[model samples]
Target chain A: MSALRRVVRAFPSLLRVGLAEMVAYRAEVIVWILTSTLPLVMLAVWDRVAQDGAVQGFGQGDFARYFAVALVVRQLTGTWVVWELNQQIRTGSLSAALLKPTHPLAWFAAESLATMPIRAVVLIPLIAVIALWRPEMGVGFEPANAPAFVLSVLLAFGVHFLVQTIFGCLAFWLDQSLGLFNVWFAVWALFSGYIAPIALMPDGLRAAVEWLPFRALLGIPVEIGAGLATGPAVWSGLLVQLSWLASCAVLAAFVWRRGVLRYGAVGA
Target chain B: MSGRAFRAILAQWRAAWMAALQYRSNFLADTLVTALWVGWTIVPLWFVFHRAPERLAGWSYDESLLVTGFFMMLQGVLEALIEPNLRGLVEHVRHGTLDFVLLKPVDSQVLVSFGRVVPAKAMLSVGGLVVVLVGIARLPVAPDLGALLVAPVLLMAGLAALYGLWLLVVSTSFWFVRVDNLSYLLTSILDAGRWPMGLYRPALRAILTFVVPVGIMTTWPALALRGLMRPTDVAVSLTIAATMLVTSRLVWRRAVASYTSASS
Candidate 1:
């Protein structure tokens, strides 16, 4: 309880520092932001493929909508915590953070949140463009779906952060957890709908990916944004997302507790 | 190309080799990472082909895989040689170590480009070669001997073009100081090159061909392997490579001249 209180108290200052740090490296951030444009590349490929005829019910317009939504969801929910944590662990600078009364994960969460302003700058314009020009893509500001979309996006961010935290904690046991993170990223790129719509997957692959946390991180929020998810489906998907988030959070905390013990023994 | 410079470069490679040998376990891990990277890139193409009832943008499934294979080879070259060297450039500029590099008797560009090698990353290119061979075997017809001979030359041209592009991107670090993510912009472009160039819109196709030349770097190699490339196409690719090489050299010289050492 006291740790939680301390974190809450420290969050604003951490957020201020994070935002300053992000701005100080704004040139790098701008370059990093372009990495998310891969979906735009996929969009081009799929859009052309669908130009002649629909593929499994996705026409050019559907692909346009799917990839645009993917761009938005991806920008919002992307996590670099694994990389950050892995670096800190490897350098043993994590001890400096360990000395704080507030948890290091809480600081990481704050830094992740700080990047939102810049992300929103890019996202809002995209929302405007989609709303004004390509309304048929169904990405316009619809009031009914707005609440559900917001909730799903939040859960998606949480699930992504917690999952990365769990993986980052693997550094406690491995020489280079970043390698494992790369492996995870490769799998996630396929299953998380970063490359394409999960609905477009073959039934067997789709069935397997749906149960994994990756889908909830990207696919579910994107589906909601496209207005393809609704009512009971929305509620059920949120439940699944929340469940994944809870489990990952628990695993992250458990791993951190054990990992910190190992860190202390190794370093001190 | 002088003997002393060549010997100096060889000595650096020896040092890099010893360093790599000391951390040889990283090779196994790097091999797995390379496989995963290849798989991640290809799976989307597999899904697209599996779900579509017809061919994609006039290319068959196997033809596209050939493009993917070529793209993987380019990525291997990037990861193994280009990215590491360019990253060293960024570190040099940031930490003011470019002074030491400037003091050396050999050409600074050659030293910056080929001085360090991650010997373990040989696995990535080896894996890429395996994929290329597999893609060749899966093709409907064997390539003509002449076309096979031209393919590797064109691939070297492609590598030259990419190195030029990377130089242009990394040269910005002289001014920007902390643009580490700049390499990833090139990477994202390479990612786009994994697909057949014909799949893009005409404007984008033109951009990829003329501006970035990713189309030539990847698609032309695959086309050559399939015995489908024209003589004019090879000429154009070589010209593009030469143009990029000269342009990047000029830009790199100017960028270096503008450098004032870091504040610290």
Candidate 2:
């Protein structure tokens, strides 16, 4: 209870620091954002493929919309927390963080959240230009879906951060959790619709991936924001996101607790 | 190409080999990572092909695998050699560690380029070859012998161009100080290499073939394997490799000359 209160009390300062840090590294952040433009590449290939005809109900415009929104979702949710955590843990600089009055994860979470306002500032104008030019992607921006889309993106971000925290916690036991995270990343890239829309997946694969956290963390917001999902689908998607957000939060806390006990600060 | 340079490079490899041998257990983990990555490489093709009822941009699924295999080989080469060396060069520049290299009595470029070797990454290249062979086996006709011969040479041209590109990017760190993620833009281009060049729009195809030449680097080799390449492309690729290598060398020298040490 006290830890929770302390984190809440400290969050404004933590967020200010995070936002300042992100702003200082703004150029790097933009470059980092641009580096994940694999979806746009996939968008090109798929757009070309769809030019032949709509394949699995996706026309060129649909792909443009899906990928554009997917890019937004990725930029919003992605954080370097795993690398930050893994480095700190491996180098034992995590001890410096451990000495803080509040939990370290709170600061990490603050940093992740801090990237948003700046990213949005960058994203909004791009979104405007893209929407103005290719207005087909302008779907689901209606007030009806806006709140749901917002919530889904936030939950997705939560799930993604917590998942990364869990993986970063693996560094407590494994020598290079980054390798393990690479495996996770590759799988995530496929299942998360980063490479291609999960809608286009074969039925069996889609069925299987639906239960996984990857899609919940990435695809649902894209789907919602792109208007691929309707009223019932939106509610169900939010429910799934909430469940994932809750479960991953628990899992991350559990992993951290267990992992921190094993922290002998080998580097220290 | 000289005997002493060859021996010096050989010694670097020997040290790399012994260092890898010292951590034998990492072999299993490295192999596992390679296996998973290879799966990531192949699985996306399945999804894209599943949607395409017929050939995807004039290439069959089996045929596309050839491109994927070639792409993987280039990727392995990047991960194994170019990325590590150039990334090290960036750090060396940032921290002024290049002074040691400048002091060394050899071609600074050659030493920096070939100094680091990740022997464990050999598995990724081997994995790529296995996929290429598999794709070859599934082909309607055997890949022609002449084509096979040209494939490796073309692949070297591709690799040389990529290495040149990386060197050029590293050279920019002399001014930019932190251009780390800039290299990933090249990587994103390489990621697009998995698909057949025909799959890209004409403008993109032209860009990939002429401007960036990722098509030449990855796709041309696969096309050569299937006896689909124009003889003219081979010349173009070689020209590109030579141009890139020469240009990168000129740029690197200029950058080196202008370099004020970042550290005292």
Candidate 3:
């Protein structure tokens, strides 16, 4: 309750700083958005492949909708805080955060949230393009599913942020967490549908990826957005997401406390 | 032209080496990171071959491995030399540190291009070479000595092409200081080079080979390993690399001449 109160108190300042930083990096943000055209390239390739015959369950139109939604979903759920936190901890700049009254997680969350407004600007055009190019492909924003979808997105963000923080905290124990982060990212890229849909994976791998948290982080929201999943699958996926979120949140908080202690002892 | 310039270059290299030594642990981590990246490339081939153990895009699994191995080697070289040095050009240009670099008696371009040598990345390059050698040994049709000879030449051309591309991007900082993220754009495009260019659509293949020229950096060396290089492809790749290098040099000179530091 006290942590929540502190976050509430510091939220405005955090948002202000985040917005300023976002504005300062506006050109970079634009370039980042533009550089996310990999999904579009994949979409083109898959669509061509499905031009003559469907690949498994995906037709050309399905490929278009899948990749387009995947792109948007990736943008929404992306968390690069691991890189920031790792750099800060390694350089001992995280001490600055420890001195703050508010929890560091609150500050990071605020910064991540602040970037959403700018992201919405990029997302709007992408939505327009999707609407124009593939209007028939939507999963339908049903009233019942809307709340669940929103909840899933939030839970996904929680998992992503917490996992990144865990990796960041590894810097206290290890010399550099970048290699671990790279390995994790490679797993995420392959299993999380960042490169391709988990559904498109070979049966055994698809089954394995489905059980993993990576798919819950990226693919589920995409699947929800595409209206490909519903009912029990949605609830079960949400349950899994929440479970992972809770576990990661606990792990991150625990590791962070210990890591900070170590940093203090080492006088870095 | 002067002995002083040579001394300055050597001094810079020594300084970079000493700095890298201070964080020796990071060297191991970076090497592991490169190894993981190399592993990432091989996984896709494993899956592709598991599905159909013959070939992809008209090349056997071993050939694909050759492509990936050569690309990794070339990428290691770029990261070791050009990337670490010129990556900071935007920050230097923004902060007016370029003036200090310019005031030196040495050729600024050469200095800027080789200012920092990432020791960890040099290790990664050695790793990439080992991967290439192992891959060659496993090939059904053994590569001849000529292929091995041409490999380094092609790799050098590829590295020059990449450095030229990066220099062009870095020079944009003179006009737009916010283009630091342009390196991210370059890396993402290079990621596409991990696969054979033949797998892409004709238009995309053309763009990757000619416009981006990533195919020349990665695929040509792999093709050489397979003894598939026609004289025409070799000539075109060399021409492209040379053209890009000259063009980037011209652009760099012009950008520097026109640069009015942000501090002013």
lDDT comparison, 1 vs 3, better candidate:
1
lDDT of 1 by residue, B61-156 (tens): 888888887887887888778889999999999999898888889888888887877766656666667777888887888888897898899889
Per-residue lDDT of model 3, residues B1-264, tens digit only: 367777887898899889888887976677677776777767765654444425556777777777777777777877788777877777788798888788888888888877778877776667767777887889888989888878778877887788889899888878977676788888788877766666677877898887788888778888888888877878888898998899999999999899886665
Docking class for candidate 1: medium
lDDT of 2 by residue, A1-268 (tens): 9989999999999999999999999988877776777876788778778877888778777887888888889889978889998999888999989999989989998998898887787777766654664576554344577789889998898898988999999999984589878778888998988888888998999999999988887889988888888789999999999998899989988999999999978667
Considering only N, C-alpha and C atoms within 3 Å, which residue pairs clash in candidate 2? none
What is the C-alpha lDDT profile of model 2 across B145-228, one tens digit per residue?
Answer: 899899999999988988888899889999998988888777876788888898876877898876677888778998888898
Error of 3 at B255 (Å): 3.2
Off by over 4 Å in 3: A9-17, A35-38, A41-52, A87-101, A124-147, A171-179, A200-211, A259-268, B1-33, B48-56, B130-152, B224-229, B258-264
Q: Find the 10 residues in a row with the least total lDDT in model 2 chain A.
A: A133-142
Q: Name the candidate that leads on lDDT.
A: 2
For model 3, chain A alone compared with the true chain A gives a TM-score of 0.91
Ranking by DockQ: 1, 2, 3
Per-model i-RMS: 1.2, 1.4, 3.3
DockQ for each model: 0.75, 0.72, 0.32
- The regions of model 2 sitting more than 4 angstroms off are A121-135, A139-143, A266-268, B262-264
**In model 1, what are the clashing residue pairs, if there are any?**
none
Score candidate 2 by DockQ.
0.72
